[model samples]
Target: MVAAALAICLRQRGLNVGVMKPVETGVGERGSTLSDAEYLRAAGGAVDPVDAIGPYRLAAPLAPLAAARQAGTVIEMDRILTAYERLAAGHTLMVVEGIGGGLVPIGHHFNVRDLIARLGLPTVVVGRATLGGVNHALLTVEALRQRRIAILGIVLNHTAIPSGPSGKGPDAIATRQGDSTVELVKELSGVPVLGPLRHEPMLAQAWEAGLGKVAAEDAIRTLADLIMQDVP
Candidate 1:
Protein backbone atom coordinates (compact mmCIF):
# COMPACT_ATOMS: atom_id res chain seq x y z
CA MET A 1 0.00 0.00 0.00
CA VAL A 2 2.80 2.40 0.90
CA ALA A 3 4.60 1.59 -2.35
CA ALA A 4 1.54 2.31 -4.46
CA ALA A 5 0.72 5.47 -2.54
CA LEU A 6 4.27 6.73 -2.89
CA ALA A 7 4.27 6.09 -6.61
CA ILE A 8 1.04 8.05 -7.04
CA CYS A 9 2.40 10.93 -4.97
CA LEU A 10 5.53 11.13 -7.10
CA ARG A 11 3.49 11.21 -10.32
CA GLN A 12 1.25 13.94 -8.93
CA ARG A 13 4.35 16.17 -8.88
CA GLY A 14 4.63 15.77 -12.69
CA LEU A 15 7.53 13.35 -12.60
CA ASN A 16 7.64 10.51 -15.06
CA VAL A 17 7.61 7.68 -12.56
CA GLY A 18 7.40 3.91 -13.03
CA VAL A 19 6.65 1.07 -10.62
CA MET A 20 7.89 -2.49 -10.23
CA LYS A 21 7.40 -5.45 -7.96
CA PRO A 22 10.01 -7.87 -9.20
CA VAL A 23 8.63 -10.82 -7.26
CA GLU A 24 5.10 -11.31 -5.97
CA THR A 25 3.61 -14.19 -4.00
CA GLY A 26 0.29 -15.00 -2.29
CA VAL A 27 -1.78 -14.35 -5.39
CA GLY A 28 -5.50 -14.74 -5.16
CA GLU A 29 -7.62 -16.80 -7.56
CA ARG A 30 -10.00 -14.07 -8.67
CA GLY A 31 -9.88 -10.39 -9.63
CA SER A 32 -6.61 -8.48 -10.14
CA THR A 33 -4.42 -11.38 -9.03
CA LEU A 34 -1.23 -9.39 -9.11
CA SER A 35 -2.76 -6.85 -6.78
CA ASP A 36 0.36 -4.96 -5.71
CA ALA A 37 1.71 -4.60 -9.20
CA GLU A 38 -1.72 -3.57 -10.46
CA TYR A 39 -2.06 -0.98 -7.73
CA LEU A 40 1.33 0.48 -8.57
CA ARG A 41 0.51 0.62 -12.27
CA ALA A 42 -2.68 2.50 -11.53
CA ALA A 43 -1.03 4.87 -9.04
CA GLY A 44 1.97 5.72 -11.24
CA GLY A 45 0.01 5.63 -14.49
CA ALA A 46 2.61 3.24 -15.78
CA VAL A 47 2.16 1.72 -19.21
CA ASP A 48 4.49 -1.20 -18.64
CA PRO A 49 3.12 -4.70 -19.12
CA VAL A 50 2.28 -6.83 -16.09
CA ASP A 51 5.28 -9.00 -16.76
CA ALA A 52 7.55 -5.97 -16.60
CA ILE A 53 5.94 -4.71 -13.44
CA GLY A 54 6.23 -8.14 -11.78
CA PRO A 55 8.50 -10.61 -13.46
CA TYR A 56 7.68 -13.42 -11.06
CA ARG A 57 4.17 -14.10 -9.83
CA LEU A 58 3.99 -17.13 -7.56
CA ALA A 59 0.75 -18.83 -6.58
CA ALA A 60 1.73 -19.95 -3.10
CA PRO A 61 1.65 -17.40 -0.31
CA LEU A 62 5.21 -17.97 0.78
CA ALA A 63 8.74 -16.72 0.28
CA PRO A 64 9.81 -16.34 -3.32
CA LEU A 65 12.13 -19.33 -3.42
CA ALA A 66 9.65 -21.60 -1.73
CA ALA A 67 6.82 -20.41 -3.91
CA ALA A 68 8.88 -20.83 -7.08
CA ARG A 69 9.94 -24.31 -6.05
CA GLN A 70 6.36 -25.25 -5.33
CA ALA A 71 5.30 -24.00 -8.76
CA GLY A 72 8.14 -25.92 -10.49
CA THR A 73 10.03 -22.82 -11.58
CA VAL A 74 13.04 -20.76 -10.65
CA ILE A 75 13.33 -17.00 -10.27
CA GLU A 76 15.56 -15.55 -12.96
CA MET A 77 17.50 -12.58 -11.68
CA ASP A 78 18.64 -11.58 -15.14
CA ARG A 79 15.07 -11.32 -16.35
CA ILE A 80 14.14 -9.08 -13.45
CA LEU A 81 17.16 -6.89 -14.09
CA THR A 82 16.36 -6.63 -17.77
CA ALA A 83 12.78 -5.62 -17.03
CA TYR A 84 13.92 -3.07 -14.46
CA GLU A 85 16.42 -1.55 -16.88
CA ARG A 86 13.68 -1.13 -19.43
CA LEU A 87 11.41 0.65 -16.96
CA ALA A 88 14.26 2.78 -15.60
CA ALA A 89 15.20 3.93 -19.06
CA GLY A 90 11.66 5.08 -19.79
CA HIS A 91 11.04 7.01 -16.57
CA THR A 92 12.81 9.66 -14.53
CA LEU A 93 12.26 7.53 -11.42
CA MET A 94 11.11 4.03 -10.59
CA VAL A 95 9.53 2.80 -7.40
CA VAL A 96 10.49 -0.83 -6.85
CA GLU A 97 8.67 -2.57 -4.04
CA GLY A 98 10.40 -5.40 -2.18
CA ILE A 99 8.60 -8.51 -1.04
CA GLY A 100 8.17 -9.52 2.59
CA GLY A 101 11.12 -8.22 4.64
CA GLY A 102 14.79 -7.54 3.98
CA LEU A 103 15.93 -11.07 4.71
CA VAL A 104 13.36 -12.75 2.49
CA PRO A 105 14.74 -15.23 -0.02
CA ILE A 106 14.20 -14.50 -3.69
CA GLY A 107 16.32 -17.36 -5.02
CA HIS A 108 18.63 -20.10 -3.87
CA HIS A 109 21.64 -17.86 -3.28
CA PHE A 110 20.00 -14.44 -3.28
CA ASN A 111 17.81 -12.55 -0.83
CA VAL A 112 15.98 -9.25 -0.85
CA ARG A 113 19.10 -7.56 0.54
CA ASP A 114 21.21 -8.95 -2.29
CA LEU A 115 18.65 -7.76 -4.82
CA ILE A 116 18.69 -4.25 -3.35
CA ALA A 117 22.47 -4.22 -3.49
CA ARG A 118 22.42 -5.39 -7.08
CA LEU A 119 19.91 -2.71 -8.08
CA GLY A 120 21.78 -0.02 -6.12
CA LEU A 121 18.55 1.64 -5.03
CA PRO A 122 18.08 3.23 -1.65
CA THR A 123 15.37 1.61 0.48
CA VAL A 124 12.46 2.98 2.44
CA VAL A 125 11.67 0.51 5.21
CA VAL A 126 7.94 0.33 5.89
CA GLY A 127 6.85 -1.13 9.20
CA ARG A 128 3.89 -1.16 11.52
CA ALA A 129 3.52 1.58 14.13
CA THR A 130 2.39 -0.42 17.11
CA LEU A 131 3.70 -2.24 20.15
CA GLY A 132 7.07 -3.91 19.47
CA GLY A 133 7.44 -1.91 16.27
CA VAL A 134 10.66 -0.34 17.48
CA ASN A 135 12.44 -3.66 17.74
CA HIS A 136 11.32 -4.84 14.33
CA ALA A 137 12.26 -1.53 12.67
CA LEU A 138 15.68 -1.43 14.31
CA LEU A 139 16.44 -5.00 13.31
CA THR A 140 15.51 -4.23 9.71
CA VAL A 141 17.68 -1.11 9.74
CA GLU A 142 20.61 -3.02 11.16
CA ALA A 143 20.30 -5.74 8.55
CA LEU A 144 20.23 -3.19 5.73
CA ARG A 145 23.15 -1.23 7.21
CA GLN A 146 25.17 -4.43 7.49
CA ARG A 147 24.89 -4.84 3.73
CA ARG A 148 25.77 -1.14 3.20
CA ILE A 149 22.42 -0.52 1.51
CA ALA A 150 21.46 3.15 1.39
CA ILE A 151 18.28 3.62 3.39
CA LEU A 152 16.13 6.56 2.37
CA GLY A 153 14.13 6.49 5.58
CA ILE A 154 11.52 4.62 7.60
CA VAL A 155 7.74 4.84 7.29
CA LEU A 156 5.68 3.65 10.24
CA ASN A 157 2.33 2.63 8.78
CA HIS A 158 -0.62 2.13 11.05
CA THR A 159 -2.42 -0.90 9.69
CA ALA A 160 -5.15 -1.01 12.28
CA ILE A 161 -7.01 1.45 14.48
CA PRO A 162 -6.43 1.13 18.17
CA SER A 163 -9.60 0.59 20.08
CA GLY A 164 -10.35 2.65 23.16
CA PRO A 165 -13.08 2.54 25.76
CA SER A 166 -16.35 1.81 23.98
CA GLY A 167 -14.17 1.07 20.94
CA LYS A 168 -14.48 4.63 19.68
CA GLY A 169 -10.94 5.06 18.41
CA PRO A 170 -7.28 4.87 19.28
CA ASP A 171 -6.78 5.07 22.98
CA ALA A 172 -4.07 6.95 24.85
CA ILE A 173 -1.93 3.83 25.22
CA ALA A 174 -1.92 3.09 21.52
CA THR A 175 -1.08 6.70 20.66
CA ARG A 176 1.83 6.76 23.07
CA GLN A 177 3.13 3.45 21.78
CA GLY A 178 2.96 4.64 18.20
CA ASP A 179 4.78 7.87 19.03
CA SER A 180 7.49 6.00 20.91
CA THR A 181 7.93 3.55 18.06
CA VAL A 182 8.57 6.38 15.60
CA GLU A 183 11.06 8.19 17.85
CA LEU A 184 13.00 5.09 18.81
CA VAL A 185 13.28 3.84 15.25
CA LYS A 186 14.79 7.16 14.17
CA GLU A 187 17.14 7.47 17.14
CA LEU A 188 18.36 3.90 16.89
CA SER A 189 18.52 3.44 13.14
CA GLY A 190 19.93 6.91 12.38
CA VAL A 191 17.34 7.08 9.61
CA PRO A 192 14.69 9.77 9.39
CA VAL A 193 11.10 8.77 10.17
CA LEU A 194 9.29 10.07 7.12
CA GLY A 195 5.78 9.38 8.33
CA PRO A 196 3.60 7.82 11.00
CA LEU A 197 0.40 7.56 9.02
CA ARG A 198 -2.59 7.65 11.33
CA HIS A 199 -4.87 4.64 11.07
CA GLU A 200 -7.45 5.25 8.37
CA PRO A 201 -9.73 2.51 7.13
CA MET A 202 -10.60 4.67 4.16
CA LEU A 203 -7.12 4.17 2.69
CA ALA A 204 -7.77 0.46 2.34
CA GLN A 205 -11.17 1.14 0.87
CA ALA A 206 -9.59 3.52 -1.63
CA TRP A 207 -6.98 0.95 -2.53
CA GLU A 208 -9.71 -1.59 -3.14
CA ALA A 209 -11.59 0.90 -5.29
CA GLY A 210 -8.83 1.40 -7.88
CA LEU A 211 -5.44 1.92 -6.25
CA GLY A 212 -4.97 5.06 -8.35
CA LYS A 213 -3.20 8.30 -7.48
CA VAL A 214 -6.60 9.85 -6.79
CA ALA A 215 -6.96 7.43 -3.89
CA ALA A 216 -3.72 8.45 -2.23
CA GLU A 217 -4.09 10.55 0.90
CA ASP A 218 -2.32 13.85 1.63
CA ALA A 219 0.03 12.16 4.10
CA ILE A 220 1.13 9.76 1.38
CA ARG A 221 1.98 12.68 -0.90
CA THR A 222 4.09 14.31 1.79
CA LEU A 223 5.94 11.07 2.36
CA ALA A 224 6.57 10.73 -1.36
CA ASP A 225 8.08 14.22 -1.56
CA LEU A 226 10.37 13.46 1.35
CA ILE A 227 11.61 10.34 -0.45
CA MET A 228 12.41 12.41 -3.56
CA GLN A 229 14.32 14.91 -1.44
CA ASP A 230 16.75 12.16 -0.46
CA VAL A 231 17.19 10.95 -4.03
CA PRO A 232 20.32 12.00 -5.83
Candidate 2:
Protein backbone atom coordinates (compact mmCIF):
# COMPACT_ATOMS: atom_id res chain seq x y z
CA MET A 1 0.00 0.00 0.00
CA VAL A 2 2.83 2.42 0.82
CA ALA A 3 4.42 1.64 -2.52
CA ALA A 4 1.16 2.36 -4.28
CA ALA A 5 0.84 5.65 -2.44
CA LEU A 6 4.42 6.47 -3.37
CA ALA A 7 3.55 5.93 -7.02
CA ILE A 8 0.62 8.26 -6.64
CA CYS A 9 2.83 10.87 -5.04
CA LEU A 10 5.43 10.62 -7.75
CA ARG A 11 2.85 11.05 -10.48
CA GLN A 12 1.22 13.91 -8.62
CA ARG A 13 4.61 15.58 -8.64
CA GLY A 14 4.47 15.42 -12.47
CA LEU A 15 6.80 12.51 -13.00
CA ASN A 16 5.98 9.75 -15.47
CA VAL A 17 5.66 6.99 -12.91
CA GLY A 18 5.86 3.27 -13.58
CA VAL A 19 4.79 0.60 -11.12
CA MET A 20 5.60 -3.12 -10.93
CA LYS A 21 4.95 -5.97 -8.56
CA PRO A 22 7.20 -8.49 -10.39
CA VAL A 23 5.17 -11.34 -8.83
CA GLU A 24 1.75 -11.09 -7.21
CA THR A 25 0.08 -13.90 -5.28
CA GLY A 26 -3.67 -14.38 -4.69
CA VAL A 27 -4.53 -12.52 -7.86
CA GLY A 28 -7.76 -14.05 -9.03
CA GLU A 29 -8.59 -14.88 -12.63
CA ARG A 30 -9.88 -12.42 -15.20
CA GLY A 31 -12.88 -10.32 -14.04
CA SER A 32 -11.91 -10.71 -10.44
CA THR A 33 -11.41 -7.69 -8.15
CA LEU A 34 -8.41 -5.40 -8.52
CA SER A 35 -5.11 -7.01 -7.62
CA ASP A 36 -2.14 -5.21 -6.09
CA ALA A 37 -0.69 -4.65 -9.52
CA GLU A 38 -3.92 -3.11 -10.72
CA TYR A 39 -4.12 -0.84 -7.72
CA LEU A 40 -0.54 0.25 -8.32
CA ARG A 41 -1.23 0.85 -12.00
CA ALA A 42 -4.23 2.95 -11.04
CA ALA A 43 -2.14 4.81 -8.54
CA GLY A 44 0.34 5.87 -11.17
CA GLY A 45 -2.31 6.36 -13.81
CA ALA A 46 -0.20 4.09 -15.99
CA VAL A 47 -1.59 2.67 -19.22
CA ASP A 48 0.68 -0.37 -19.19
CA PRO A 49 -0.97 -3.75 -19.45
CA VAL A 50 -1.29 -5.74 -16.23
CA ASP A 51 1.03 -8.42 -17.60
CA ALA A 52 3.80 -5.90 -18.00
CA ILE A 53 3.13 -4.44 -14.56
CA GLY A 54 3.09 -7.70 -12.63
CA PRO A 55 4.45 -10.30 -15.04
CA TYR A 56 3.43 -13.19 -12.76
CA ARG A 57 0.05 -13.43 -11.00
CA LEU A 58 -0.39 -16.53 -8.86
CA ALA A 59 -3.81 -17.65 -7.64
CA ALA A 60 -2.86 -18.78 -4.16
CA PRO A 61 -2.23 -16.18 -1.48
CA LEU A 62 1.14 -17.64 -0.63
CA ALA A 63 4.76 -16.76 -1.20
CA PRO A 64 5.62 -16.37 -4.89
CA LEU A 65 7.75 -19.50 -4.98
CA ALA A 66 5.17 -21.52 -3.08
CA ALA A 67 2.27 -20.26 -5.15
CA ALA A 68 4.08 -20.85 -8.42
CA ARG A 69 4.92 -24.37 -7.31
CA GLN A 70 1.27 -25.04 -6.51
CA ALA A 71 0.30 -23.89 -10.01
CA GLY A 72 2.91 -26.14 -11.64
CA THR A 73 4.88 -23.12 -12.77
CA VAL A 74 8.28 -21.58 -12.21
CA ILE A 75 9.37 -17.97 -11.73
CA GLU A 76 12.09 -16.93 -14.13
CA MET A 77 14.18 -13.89 -13.19
CA ASP A 78 14.92 -13.11 -16.81
CA ARG A 79 11.19 -12.85 -17.53
CA ILE A 80 10.68 -10.46 -14.62
CA LEU A 81 13.65 -8.33 -15.59
CA THR A 82 12.36 -8.24 -19.15
CA ALA A 83 9.03 -6.91 -17.96
CA TYR A 84 10.71 -4.38 -15.66
CA GLU A 85 12.94 -3.05 -18.41
CA ARG A 86 9.99 -2.75 -20.77
CA LEU A 87 8.10 -0.62 -18.25
CA ALA A 88 11.18 1.36 -17.23
CA ALA A 89 11.86 2.31 -20.78
CA GLY A 90 8.98 4.80 -20.89
CA HIS A 91 8.81 6.06 -17.33
CA THR A 92 10.72 8.52 -15.22
CA LEU A 93 11.17 5.98 -12.41
CA MET A 94 10.01 2.47 -11.68
CA VAL A 95 8.49 1.64 -8.31
CA VAL A 96 8.88 -2.11 -7.89
CA GLU A 97 7.25 -3.54 -4.80
CA GLY A 98 8.67 -6.63 -3.16
CA ILE A 99 6.49 -9.73 -2.86
CA GLY A 100 6.94 -9.80 0.87
CA GLY A 101 10.00 -9.27 3.00
CA GLY A 102 13.48 -9.24 1.53
CA LEU A 103 13.89 -13.00 2.07
CA VAL A 104 10.70 -13.99 0.22
CA PRO A 105 11.44 -16.77 -2.22
CA ILE A 106 10.84 -16.22 -5.91
CA GLY A 107 12.49 -19.13 -7.68
CA HIS A 108 13.71 -22.30 -5.97
CA HIS A 109 17.02 -20.66 -5.12
CA PHE A 110 16.35 -16.96 -5.55
CA ASN A 111 14.86 -14.50 -3.06
CA VAL A 112 13.45 -10.97 -3.20
CA ARG A 113 16.80 -9.56 -2.04
CA ASP A 114 18.50 -11.21 -4.99
CA LEU A 115 15.91 -9.65 -7.25
CA ILE A 116 16.50 -6.22 -5.72
CA ALA A 117 20.24 -6.62 -6.09
CA ARG A 118 19.65 -7.56 -9.72
CA LEU A 119 17.34 -4.61 -10.32
CA GLY A 120 19.85 -2.44 -8.49
CA LEU A 121 17.22 -0.15 -7.00
CA PRO A 122 17.37 1.64 -3.71
CA THR A 123 14.65 0.38 -1.34
CA VAL A 124 12.44 2.01 1.26
CA VAL A 125 11.78 -0.45 4.06
CA VAL A 126 8.15 -0.37 5.16
CA GLY A 127 7.72 -1.90 8.59
CA ARG A 128 4.60 -2.56 10.62
CA ALA A 129 4.40 -0.21 13.57
CA THR A 130 3.43 -2.63 16.30
CA LEU A 131 5.00 -4.69 19.00
CA GLY A 132 8.05 -6.67 17.76
CA GLY A 133 8.45 -4.25 14.83
CA VAL A 134 11.87 -3.26 16.06
CA ASN A 135 13.22 -6.72 15.38
CA HIS A 136 11.50 -7.11 12.03
CA ALA A 137 12.46 -3.59 10.88
CA LEU A 138 16.06 -3.79 12.01
CA LEU A 139 16.58 -7.28 10.63
CA THR A 140 15.31 -6.12 7.23
CA VAL A 141 17.62 -3.11 7.25
CA GLU A 142 20.51 -5.39 8.17
CA ALA A 143 19.65 -7.81 5.38
CA LEU A 144 19.71 -5.02 2.77
CA ARG A 145 22.88 -3.52 4.20
CA GLN A 146 24.60 -6.92 4.11
CA ARG A 147 23.88 -7.09 0.36
CA ARG A 148 25.18 -3.53 -0.11
CA ILE A 149 21.81 -2.30 -1.35
CA ALA A 150 21.23 1.45 -1.03
CA ILE A 151 18.75 2.05 1.77
CA LEU A 152 16.39 4.87 0.87
CA GLY A 153 14.65 5.04 4.25
CA ILE A 154 12.11 3.22 6.40
CA VAL A 155 8.34 3.78 6.57
CA LEU A 156 6.62 2.37 9.63
CA ASN A 157 2.95 1.72 9.02
CA HIS A 158 0.34 1.24 11.67
CA THR A 159 -1.96 -1.41 10.28
CA ALA A 160 -4.38 -1.31 13.18
CA ILE A 161 -4.83 -0.48 16.81
CA PRO A 162 -5.92 -3.61 18.61
CA SER A 163 -7.64 -3.76 21.96
CA GLY A 164 -5.69 -4.49 25.09
CA PRO A 165 -6.92 -6.27 28.20
CA SER A 166 -8.59 -2.96 29.04
CA GLY A 167 -10.90 -3.49 26.08
CA LYS A 168 -11.46 -1.60 22.80
CA GLY A 169 -10.86 2.13 22.82
CA PRO A 170 -8.32 4.67 21.59
CA ASP A 171 -6.57 4.52 24.95
CA ALA A 172 -6.00 0.78 24.76
CA ILE A 173 -2.62 -0.40 25.94
CA ALA A 174 -2.01 -2.05 22.60
CA THR A 175 -2.41 1.33 20.93
CA ARG A 176 0.42 2.65 22.99
CA GLN A 177 2.45 -0.41 22.13
CA GLY A 178 1.90 0.19 18.45
CA ASP A 179 2.76 3.86 18.82
CA SER A 180 5.92 3.01 20.74
CA THR A 181 7.25 0.70 18.06
CA VAL A 182 7.83 3.67 15.76
CA GLU A 183 9.90 5.44 18.39
CA LEU A 184 11.87 2.32 19.19
CA VAL A 185 12.66 1.70 15.56
CA LYS A 186 13.75 5.30 15.04
CA GLU A 187 16.05 5.19 18.02
CA LEU A 188 17.78 2.12 16.73
CA SER A 189 17.69 2.34 12.95
CA GLY A 190 20.66 4.40 11.75
CA VAL A 191 19.03 4.91 8.35
CA PRO A 192 16.45 7.67 7.91
CA VAL A 193 12.97 6.60 9.08
CA LEU A 194 10.08 8.23 7.24
CA GLY A 195 6.54 7.46 8.34
CA PRO A 196 4.28 5.81 10.83
CA LEU A 197 1.52 5.84 8.20
CA ARG A 198 -1.78 5.73 10.05
CA HIS A 199 -4.14 2.85 9.41
CA GLU A 200 -6.36 3.78 6.47
CA PRO A 201 -8.72 0.96 5.57
CA MET A 202 -10.36 3.13 2.93
CA LEU A 203 -7.48 2.36 0.58
CA ALA A 204 -8.95 -1.07 -0.13
CA GLN A 205 -12.29 0.40 -1.13
CA ALA A 206 -11.45 3.83 -2.56
CA TRP A 207 -8.12 3.83 -4.35
CA GLU A 208 -7.88 7.44 -5.49
CA ALA A 209 -9.26 9.06 -2.38
CA GLY A 210 -7.19 6.92 -0.04
CA LEU A 211 -3.99 7.35 -2.02
CA GLY A 212 -4.68 11.01 -2.56
CA LYS A 213 -4.85 11.54 1.15
CA VAL A 214 -1.62 9.64 1.65
CA ALA A 215 0.08 11.50 -1.18
CA ALA A 216 -0.70 14.82 0.46
CA GLU A 217 0.98 13.82 3.66
CA ASP A 218 4.21 15.63 4.54
CA ALA A 219 5.89 12.30 5.17
CA ILE A 220 4.99 10.92 1.77
CA ARG A 221 6.15 14.15 0.15
CA THR A 222 9.44 13.97 1.99
CA LEU A 223 9.85 10.36 1.01
CA ALA A 224 9.14 11.26 -2.59
CA ASP A 225 11.76 13.95 -2.46
CA LEU A 226 14.26 11.43 -1.14
CA ILE A 227 13.37 8.95 -3.89
CA MET A 228 13.84 11.64 -6.57
CA GLN A 229 17.30 12.34 -5.24
CA ASP A 230 18.29 8.66 -5.40
CA VAL A 231 16.88 7.84 -8.84
CA PRO A 232 18.48 9.20 -12.03
Candidate with maximal TM-score: 2
In candidate 2, what are the lDDT values of residues 1-232, reduced to their tens digit? 8888888898878899999999999987535678989999998899999889989999998989999999999999999999999999999899998978999999998999999999999998998888889999999999999999999899988776765566656646667787788888889989888778877877778867887888777778889999888566
Clashing pairs in 2: none
The CA lDDT of each predicted structure is 0.81, 0.88
Residue runs of model 1 more than 4 Å from their true location after superposition: 29-34, 208-219, 230-232
For all candidates, what are the clash counts? 0, 0
Candidate 2, residue 198: lDDT: 78
**After best superposition, candidate 1 residue 115: deviation in angstroms?**
0.2
Cα RMSDs, all models: 2.5, 2.0
